[model samples]
Structures are given as structure tokens and as C-alpha cells.
Target: MVIMTATEPATAGTAQTETGTEIETASDAGTAPGPGPGTGSAPGAPAGPVRPVEALLLVDLQSAFVAGGEAVPDAARVLDRSRALLARARAAGALVVHLQNDGAPGTVDEPHTPGWRLHLPVAPGPRETVVRKTGDDGFDGTPLGALLTDAGVEALTLCGVLSEMCVSATARTALARDFRVVLPHDAHATYDVPAAPGIGESVPAALASRAAEWALGDDVEIVARAAEVTFTAARPGCGTGSRAGSRTER
Candidate 1:
């Protein structure tokens, strides 16, 4: 796994860190119970008929990765955005899947290590799915793929720590599997690491954002922020329409 640090100054036209600030604080913005199966809406609008998305995949939002001391830089800044996405997803009735990186034994992220658990403030809901994996790619050797297929998901909205590592890998895997991927760049973060092990090199945020943009290709859509990503009521032929139901986790 290659750890790259980002040092580009926040610039105009780039994904802004506060894209979802308004939605995050609006008290009226609660999870809306989606329309039940067989009930469809007009096409192309917010109320348009949407494929039943059974899950919201969150990558490596663990304590070891987000809290101070072991946290990713700007991790705190992104929590509200992450939480806002989670809330909207739940309202639209998508399953919340939390992915945790399990390092090799004796490492910082090993099972039972402080770093292995998810960060505080955002807890998993009762029906949420939590999957643990020993590799950077959450789907590698894990049941994530099967669970998603089983739930009949047609798309995936991914967010979490380390924009260049697990998030990138998981997005690639999802695309290869033919699943529509939605990635909001501002909802993710990464740490600065010396590019040559000992030598300093900053992984430009533009590069990270561009990599995410490229990953989607003609199939994926990159939204500027999580709030811009629409979540609608599930309709029939789309499988189960329950909000906050089962979804694939990464």
C-alpha cells in the first residue's frame, strides 16, 4: 500500500471542504422514509424513480484513523460532511456499511487495537452493517461483494478516510463489478507522507481529486459534495424498498 500526502492549497473550482455545511445543520433535514415498492416517481428529478440502493459504503472511518494522535489530517473537518451524508442516506433508506482496516497482528490497526474501532460521534445504527478486513481493499477476501449482490444494489455512494488508499481501491473494485459509483470528493481525506520514504513529496489534492474523477469514467458521476448526491425513495422491480435496510459494505 502506498501512502501519499496531499499539500496543495485549497483552490477555487476544486472540491470545497464546506460543500455540505448547510445541509449538515438544517434541523429539518431528517431521513425521509422512501416510497415503498411499486410506487414510482417522475424521471430525472429528485422524486424520479431510483434503483433500490441497499447500502452506503463508508471506508475506514475508524478511531485509529480519524481521532487525534492517529487521525488523518483534516479528518475532523470532514466528519460533519460524512455525518450529513450518512443522515441523508438513512433518510432515503439506504443501508449504512462501515469498513474498518484490520492490519497484520501487532500493528496499529490489529483487532482490538484502539485504531481498529470506528471514531466517536458517528455510531452505527441498529441495522447498519460493519465489516472488518485485513487488507486495504475492503472487498478483498471479504463478503462485501456478495452482500451487495444479495441486496440487489444498483449503485454505491462511497466516503471515508484516505482518499488515495482504501477509498480508491474500493471505488475501482465497485466499478469493475459494474456498479454505479458516486464519490463526493470533499467527504474524504488523506495524510501527508514523504513520497520517497525519507524524502518529502506532497500528493497534490488535485491529483487525488482527478484520480477519483477518472475512476468513474463514463459510468461514474463525481459530485462536488455529498449534499448534491441525490437519494430517493426505492421503487419496484428495484427490489426491497425499505429505508435503512440491508446494503453492501466496503
Candidate 2:
């Protein structure tokens, strides 16, 4: 079952990741400093030319879906891949958006609950920010579309949890909007499907992930590994240029 539903205060603080890069909360969006040049090389920067004006969309990598015992079967790999992808994007100065889903009351991801928090640390700033969403589609009622447009994002590399729900729905919309979408095979995951009368036997999470990717159609560039994806900076005047920065999208 795809359980989709799911901010913070102003004056957000920052913490250092293992590598010492400062990570900020979504509340610091727009107000935090933008990335400086000469950060680091992208994950696959040497293997290929840096792609142009691309964004990184991380969907619902919340603790409820990617951490501890309740996590997806492939949660470990998803974390590793998403972390690498995030580092690469930030390093190359790409726009990075983290989508957080709010679950209904009594659910594992109920708003303000421990499980509802994002599992990974976000580097909120001009080019990187978080968007809280209520529906499976990240852009449904959020500022995602406007942010992408304002940043002049022509393509994007997307990764996260619940491959069949949030990931699939968001990707579907990105395609419809004509964004060159790239989904890494190893970066997104989901839980197993229990046996049911209509579906018969249970389906493993890995199979389900593949099925979700296939359903997105050929326009979406599905790659084998997350590392194969490269990155580039968002266009000039991206993060600080519009109303998207000053206001939170509900």
C-alpha cells in the first residue's frame, strides 16, 4: 500500500556532515548562503561531461520509509546511493530539492512525529531546499514546478523511497511537463507487497522498483547506477530570483 499524505521555525541552524559540509534545515531556504565554486567533483564527473542545468529531486526519504526496522528492504542501498547523488549535485552546484511527505494521524509518518523527519541532512540554501508535500506527486500542490522553472532546470536526476508511489507519481508529472528525467535503478526503493487475492503471491521490493521504473515510459532516462549520473549548476539567478525563495509552498 502506498501511504502518502505528509515545517519548522525560522532562524534555522546548520550542522556539519561527516565531511564537514554545513547542512541546513528547510526553514533556512533562500536565506542560507549559496554554494561557492570549487566545491568538489561530482560522483561521475570524470567518467562523463557535466550535464547542463540539471536538478536533483530527492523524494520522501523520511525515517519511516528509509530508516530502522520499518525501512524498505533495500533501504541501506537507497541511502548510500542518495547520499552519493546529493554530494555530487551539491558539489557541481546543481539545484537540489528534498520532498517530504506528511502522513495522516496515527500512521508511522504522522506530522511532527519522529518517523516523519527526513532521514538525510539537507543543505538548505539558495540552490538547495526542502518542500513539504501532502500528495504522492511532489508538484501536486507544492512549488516544485515553479522552482524548477525559475532555476531553468532542463533535466534532473531523481532518487528516493517508495518507488511505486511518490517516486513514480513525481516522475510521471515531470515527464508530462517535458523535463528530461533520469532515474537511477539503484537509488529508489519500496517495501514488499503482501499476498492478496487479486495479486496472488507477494512481490519483492526489487521487482516492484523495476516495475515502477518501466511504467514511467521511455522518455525517462533510466540508468543502472546512481553514480553514473553527473551534475551541473542551476542557471544563473536560480535560487534567489523569485517568490519561491521568500515564501513556503503549502
Q: Give the number of the best model, judged by lDDT.
A: 2
lDDT of 1 by residue, 57-137 (tens): 878887767786867766876677788877777787675667767678887676556666566333344335566666667
Q: Compose the digit string of candidate 2's lDDT tens values, residues 1-250.
A: 1110111112243333224344553321201111112323332222233234379999988888887889999888989999999988999988999887777899987766777877888767888887777789987877788788788777787899889999999999887776767777789999998999976899988888878876776466656667667898767444323333342211
Clashing pairs in 1: 5-192, 31-91, 32-91, 38-236, 54-247, 64-115, 93-243, 93-244
Report how far residue 243 has shifted in candidate 1, in Å.
22
Clashing pairs in 2: 5-102, 6-101, 6-102, 6-103
CA lDDT of every candidate: 0.57, 0.71
Q: How many backbone clashes does candidate 2 have?
A: 4
Q: Candidate 1 at 111: error in angstroms?
A: 0.9
CA RMSD (A), model 2:
12.2
